[model samples]
Target: MAFSLFILFLIIGVIEIYAFQAVKTFTKVKWVRLCYVIISLMSIVFIVYQFTRFDRSVGQTPMFMITVGLMLLVLIPKLLITSVLILEDGLRLIVGSRNYFNNYDKEASFLPERRRFISKVALGIAAVPFLSLIYGMTVGKYNYKVLRHTLFFDDLPDAFDGFKITQISDIHSGSFDNPEKISYAVDLINEQESDLLLFTGDIVNTNATEMHPWIDTFKKIKNHEFGKYSILGNHDYGEYVEWKSEELKNKNFEDIKDLHRQIDFKLLLNENTKLKKGNDEIALVGVENWGVKFKKVGDLNKASENLKKEDFKILMSHDPSHWDAEINTHEKDFHLTLSGHTHGFQFGIEIPGVIKWSPVEYVYKQWAGLYVNMERYLYVNRGFGFHAYPGRVGIMPEITVLELKKRKKVV
Candidate 1:
């Protein structure tokens, strides 16, 4: 552990040195240079101190969120600067070697001095993400976007045609700091007026108490005609934190489930409910968190129960990995599955139709947006709330609206 930390700090020191050189090369002002060094040192010290003081028993406090945001805000730009400087140094090394071997300019120094233009370009390039991170913390986190998709399924019940479902997932209420922003989001959800509302989980970061203050605010999400339903995400189990006792952990888990009720949402645990319209009905099956890398408690068999393969089914699973691992290949043939555990890694570039990319994509095949295979569909909500990083980048918080339509058969 000591050696690992030593290596980590050593690398950080090297990055800081190169980053500082860029600033120094860009300007000769003494105080400006001193200020840069002071700020960098202070940020490193504060980040290290806060990390050391972290208590596993009390996970994801507001202070921790702020520290994470600060660390990213300070470190990312510096890393970009350091990368440019390193590349420049590599070029300088090659050129200097060639010059020495050929005896060109004997009076010249072994290596050329760092270029101001390069420093300027590095700083310019670094500014984009630096400002973006700032915007993500202040504005992007609350920039809720309502994405609408119309899915046509031949198996869809005639009565359920044109049925709309609104989905919000990965609430992570414990990480919330702004009530006004959250209230706005709730209003946005209400504005949709979808027939049904579904929450895909992560209602709290770890402890249920994180949602206490926001209960009433979320309850404002006026009930839907078909109903409001939810399923647990991995974090809802309270497994990320160290509990005083098993009883306490269990209590927290129970309270997390109750949070769904407080918000007037029916919490589903390996259960299924049928939503009927006219004489036809569709099964809404929900299961607990099931992920390739996290907790695995969801039981599709139990959730399906008496439902048959012919029944048009909509599944609620917190992690999209469940669809890849089991749901897609199952004989039951779920028509639609909703999920939101990836949160698009809370960072990535996404341009509708043109391109969609995120680091999380490398980990989960269906990290965000809609995916279809063998006629079954899965829509992964980016997230309704922010976590660990305390903000979002290119991928904004989402409220997914899906409309069901029966596909027209051709002769």
Candidate 2:
């Protein structure tokens, strides 16, 4: 690990040097150049210092999130500049070799000076991500977008033909720095006034206490007519942090589960409830966090033990991967499954209908939005909050409103 880190820093140093050269080539002002170097060095030192102080027992603190954000903010732009400079250098090397071998510029200089135009272009390119990251931190994280989808399912109960369900996931409350934004989001959720509200989890980063401050802020979410329900996400297990003892870890898990109740959301734990509407009903089955790579505590069979395969069912599993792995192909048919663990990687290009893409897609087939297999459907909420880098890019936080329509049989 130490050797790997050493190499990583060595590469960063080289990239920084190349990036500095681009700046130097672009400007002759000494103060501007010196200021850039000083800021870069200070940022690197601060990030390293904060990382060194990170404790396994107290994982993902606000300071640690700042360090990660700062590191990415500084490093990504430099990487872009360095890549452009390296490409220019490669072309220069080929040209210089040809000139030296042919003795073409004997009186003139050995190699031509670096072009100012190239430096200008590199700077322009680097500015894109730099500004985007800044905007992501400041505004994009709180940019809540309500995505609406109408899914038609032949198995949907007639009573729920026009049922509207709102979903938000991956709160990661520990990362929230603004209360007003959260309150506004709750209001936005209330504005929907859906028949039901469901939360697919990651309520806090790691510790249960991370959500303490925002309990009341989230409690503002109004009750839905059909009811409000939630299921745990992988992070809710408190597995990312190192607890002093197993008992403490268990206690934290218990507390995390109670958070849903405090917010008026009935916490579902490998259980199924029947949402009755008049004479008909639909099975709302919720299992614990089940993922392809993360925790696998969810018991689908046990959760749906009382329900038959013919029943109209809506499964709430945190990770979308569970749908790709088991739910879609399970013995019991799940008409609709709701999930939100991917968070669209919190970075992606999503231009609805025209284009939808994210880095997380390579890992999760149903990373975001709706997906269908056979007759079953899964809707993956982008997320409600930020984590790790403490910002979002193209993939804004989401409040999903879905309307279920029963497909009529063709004559």
Candidate 3:
């Protein structure tokens, strides 16, 4: 799907460039004529399909986004030219113009005064969201502080009570070439009064060795009973990277497993543990990363092999997709699931009830914030470390302090 969109953009960009060149060169016939003729037709089809699923051929690729810019470029001139015609025609009907617009002239009446006004307003509506996106990128920072007061389950066992769980996911540790930036993130996490820290996958981008240099600083962070726990993300299994030998790749994964143990983070590896809180106990289950068409390290079968279904399980699964596919399907078995690979696309909004945003929402339904499926809930963190880009534009780095609150039973 991505490649298709890229190629489609490449084609549209070529036509846009050619059209611009033709205008600059003052060609007798605009090169945009033929290309736009096609787009004008496609737009009619696309807009219609958006309203109904009655009939269709698969779906259109979003490369049409690139086409929107091209269309506006051509539409603007047509808009202005036709707008003058409508005004002159109105005057002809009102007073009279020497070169009056006649009902007989089709081109002059192409856009009547009232319809032209409405079309211009429609164009502005289409452009508002794109402009707001730019504004959000500049003014908004993925500020995590707003999350300090969100509702949490308070009756969670003291073994994990006031247990601030600082989570960071999709670290893609190998992508960071800067050590100072990494140190800053480490310092921030360490600064929080977190009882236990959880890293729910994608710890290393392509190799287990990626998290090596930062290990020293990471060890400095406080973790104890509420120590630290981790699970594999889709990228952790080295599936996307090409290796000289499969054995070498497997060995590297093992090394990553041991490394987490060295840092005091027990890699859940499809297993559950009981954290004692006074007279009560809460279960923490960590599964290997598994999600749609990605790595399948999640061993729900193995993870729950020896555990009781009634146990209050807090699962650490990398992808939220896992919750949809496995956890949610297990009835209301697990109380809560913690996941973070989404990074909220490192962009988008999480405002509740006002206006919600995030492209990742179209991918994973529970891409950010909290979600309740039946009784099992999932919290998708926006991650601590940045991937791909070192700077965050909208989505800020996060250190979530989730206080699991429990309500008294209603008889």
TM-score of each: 0.99, 0.98, 0.67
Candidate 3 has what TM-score? 0.67
Candidate 3 displacement at residue 370 in angstroms: 0.6
* Local distance difference test values of all predictions, in order: 0.94, 0.91, 0.64
Candidate 2: list runs displaced more than 4 Å: 107-110
- What lDDT score goes with residue 23 in model 2? 91
lDDT, residue 59, candidate 2: 94
Q: Give me candidate 1's TM-score against the actual structure.
A: 0.99
Model 1 residue 230 CA deviation in Å: 0.4
Clashing pairs in 1: none
Cα lDDT tens digits for candidate 2, 267-354: 9999999999988999999999999899699999999998998999999999998997899788889999999999899888988779
lDDT of 1 at 84: 96
How far off is residue 218 in model 1, in Å? 0.9
Sorting all predicted structures by lDDT, with the top scorer first, yields 1, 2, 3
Q: Give lDDT: candidate 1, residue 206.
A: 95
True-structure lDDT of candidate 2? 0.91
